[model samples]
Target: MAEKYLIGVDGSEHSRVALAWGLARAAERNADVELLHVADDSFLSESVAFLSEAQQASQQMLDSETAYAKTLGFTGNITGTAVVGHPIAELEAASKRVDLLILGAHSGSRFAGSFFGTRAVKAAATAHCPVAVIPKHEVSPGAGIAVGIDGSEASKVAIAYAAEAASMRGVPLIAVYAWMAPLTPGLEYLWSEELVEAQRSAAEEAIAIGVAGLAERYPDLTIERRIVQSPPVAALVQVGEEVETLVVGSRGRGGISRLLLGSVSHGVLQALPCPVIVTRATA
Candidate 1:
């Protein structure tokens, strides 16, 4: 079967933006687009209590989204599905068959929490394929793409995905390696310039290794590498403003084994101005 692009839409402006971005990408790749809306079963009781008028309004919104998707040139085999279940579960089950999953950073729903809601976080962390969390703001067309690296196997996967995305979008790839000086006993106050320099050198080496590996795989891709002295999350968010997408591993070397989302990936998803893609080590 041909690969299909799946986009989760919840009848919000932010979701529409995500839909638009997905459509643009699908067109570029000549792939089919599927619009999915997962109605949380937990809301069924509350929705019924609100009256049939509220339910009708919700249905109307879904209809509007379906129409909008068609107007955006996604018709024919383009599918629209509305399933009653937990948002994360539905998407995760459906994502197993899709090539990519696109989601909005915000849905404007009261139940939708900040940074694309908890469901999106879960999906990005556990989905079999890559997840792109579209930012709520407007960004320049074909801006640079940034990928965070920490010299881990998962980070290398993210770097590879970012390299391909940059080549496909015809944009520069920025490989960022963020680092901080290790905290040693009694050395917190006596942290000298030498320690900082050493940390910076290590960060540069990490970035160099990641860039070299990606260059070996994608020799024709344009890449710019950077080693920054800051927290991983802060550096990614600050650099993501001018980029079209920020790619990072779901977990890094500092993350716990059982943890699904790493600190850097979580922070970038929350604060970045552009889309963020979380890639898995094996994927």
Candidate 2:
């Protein structure tokens, strides 16, 4: 089978933007595109005709999106698939077979909590491969790739992927490690400037060590390290605005064994200024 890049399309502008981005990215990576449309099974019990009509409409939408992709200058092989079932479950099953899963950040349905719903978060965290969630925005010129490294297995995977993406895009890679300095409740007044500098230096050093091998791997890729003294989500979102893509671990609750969608990665998906990719570590 051809290396497939699957995209979930709902005819929303957000989904269209995601399709466009996915097409270009997949083309650059020499992968085929599969446009998937799913009809909610909730209405399947309404009537047989309703189910049939809905499925037909979904197939039409997938065809429309496939046609639309060609208009966007995507000349690669494209396939459209329509089905009736739970959207998340169907997509989850498809994810195992595809090289990558691309999704629109925003959904028109009120059921989806944010731009990405609860299920989207779960899918990103649990998918077998990396999932790229594209916001309703275009890539800006000269923007670099940003990845968060927090000394976890998932994050290490994310960093490596982000570095490779940056290398492919011919841009720099910004590796951000957000940290907070711990202070004793009553000993705050005794803190010195040297102590603050040491903490900041330690944070930077940690990030540097985390990506030490990337330089050798991608000899021509430029890697910049940033140590932020704020929450991880906020730091990554801020960086996302200035970068082309924000890549992060699907799960990392600031611990070794905690490999699941945490608040930071969750927030970045919803509010990041650029496209965000959530990656799972290789087993």
Candidate 3:
């Protein structure tokens, strides 16, 4: 079966970028693309007349987006849908039926509603499948793929997804493990250089374990392992700046807090470095 990708469209520049990105990926993967536009009902009273107007507006927006998609010249199957409801709730519900959900980063437009901004983060975090947040204009034309690793089941799943993506694109994969020395309250004076070294060693081990068999699995793929001594967000963002896509777990191990969807994922999104794919562990 062909893969399916759902995209949230709001008739904004950001959503247009997302639609373009989704269409490109769909063509490469021979995946189906679904464009969704949700009209915010909260802005109007629940009167029947108001609801009717919202429905008409929603259809108009969907029609425009559908027409826009055609202009892009995508030959694959494309579906356009519009609903009069909450964007976040509608996207979260639709995400379960698709392989991936793609959305554009928030652009501070009230017309965009929940398709971007903090709501986009919330949707990505709670979605049932992997969510890709396409930045408005920060994608590197032909950079490699990168994934954050921290010795967690979530990170492992991310590694698998990133590896497959890199292999498909025939691009190198950069696996990064960022670590910082653990600090104890009131024990700051006891901290020593030895502790820092120990932490560095552990970070290296974590990344090694995280990508143990990638080489053998993708013999033709070039994998670069990076062990950085910076905070996870900073490390991932710096790497993201130079990569085509940055893949990270929805949530990671508590100790490292390297890829927690709530904090780390949110932080990376704020940077808007590149297209970030937040993958959740499968059941």
Candidate 4:
């Protein structure tokens, strides 16, 4: 069976970008595309004309998105559906069975809702599969895939996902690990150059452990491991800017905040220059 991707559409240019990006990816993967829209009844008053008109408007928006997908050169099966409910709830329920779920970084209008808020955060955190957040610009394919790591199990899963994606794209894989030594501003000179080098070496070793055995799994993949002495979010954004896609674990586990996107992941999500995939760790 062909792979399946679900995209949340809301008739905005952001949604348009998501549709185009999703379709292009589907075209490459020969996957089926499903466009979903939630018709929030909160915008309607208790009137007959308001309800009927709202339904018509919702249908038109879905129609426009369906037509837009065709123009993006997607030859696979495309299905569009509009359900009446909270946007987050509807999308969450509908995305459970798809191979991937995609949405624009922003929704409706500048004031309507934000993809960085509860809707996207919760959806991505709880989604059964992977979620791709596409920005509101025409993103042509760039270099390879980049994955953020910090030696967590979630990061390991993200690396695996990114490796598969890089392999499929026939591009190199960039494994990024960001770390920093505890130092006081004025006391920085206390640590010798050897100490800094040791810190870096430790970080590099952790990264190697994180990416260990991947070469055997994907012999054709060329992996470039990057270890930087900086915050995780900053390092990821800097490296991810040059790549076509950035993949990270959806959140971190409990104690240190590692499940799929913790605070660091959220920061990267807000500042990322390109598309990002927040992948859940599978059992």
Instruction: Report clashes for each candidate as comma-separated counts.
Output: 1, 1, 1, 10
Across residues 1-283, which tens digit of lDDT does each residue of candidate 1 receive?
Answer: 6669898877777888898999888887778878777656664565655545444554555677778988887544577776556677678788888989999876446532122666677778767788998877888777888999899998888888889889888889999988877667877987888878877888888888888866677777788988887888988888888888889887532223423677778777767568888888762
Q: Which scores greater on TM-score, model 1 or model 4?
A: 4
Every candidate's CA RMSD: 3.8, 3.4, 3.3, 3.2
Best by lDDT: 3
User: Considering summed lDDT, which 10 consecutive residues are worst modelled in model 2?
Assistant: 107-116
- Candidate 3 residues 1-283, lDDT tens each? 9999998988888889999999999999999999889997767789999889888888899899899998998999999888898877788789879999999987687573547677778777778789999888766766899999988778899999999999888899999998876667888877688878888888888888888888899998899999998899999999999999999887622332322355777898888699999988753
Kindly list the per-residue Cα lDDT of model 4 for residues 1-283, writing each as its tens digit: 9999998887777777877888878988999988887777766685888777767777787898788778777889999886655676676678787999998876346522233345666667667788888877544474989999888777888988999899988899999988887779898778898998998988888889988998999999999989888988899989877889999885533432332457766777777567989887654
Cα lDDT tens digits, model 2, 1-283, are 5678999888778788888889989888888988888877864677778878888888887888788898988778888889877777778788888988998876456431122555566668666778888877676856899999898887888888898889998999999999876666987877688988998888877897889988889999998888899988989999999988899986533333333576778888768578889888765
Ranked candidates (lDDT, high to low): 3, 2, 4, 1
Better of 2 and 4 by TM-score: 2
Inter-residue clash pairs, candidate 2: 251-260
Deviating ranges (above 4 Å) for candidate 4: 46-52, 107-118, 138-142, 183-194, 252-260
The pairs that clash in candidate 3 are: 106-117
The lDDT values for all models are: 0.77, 0.81, 0.85, 0.78
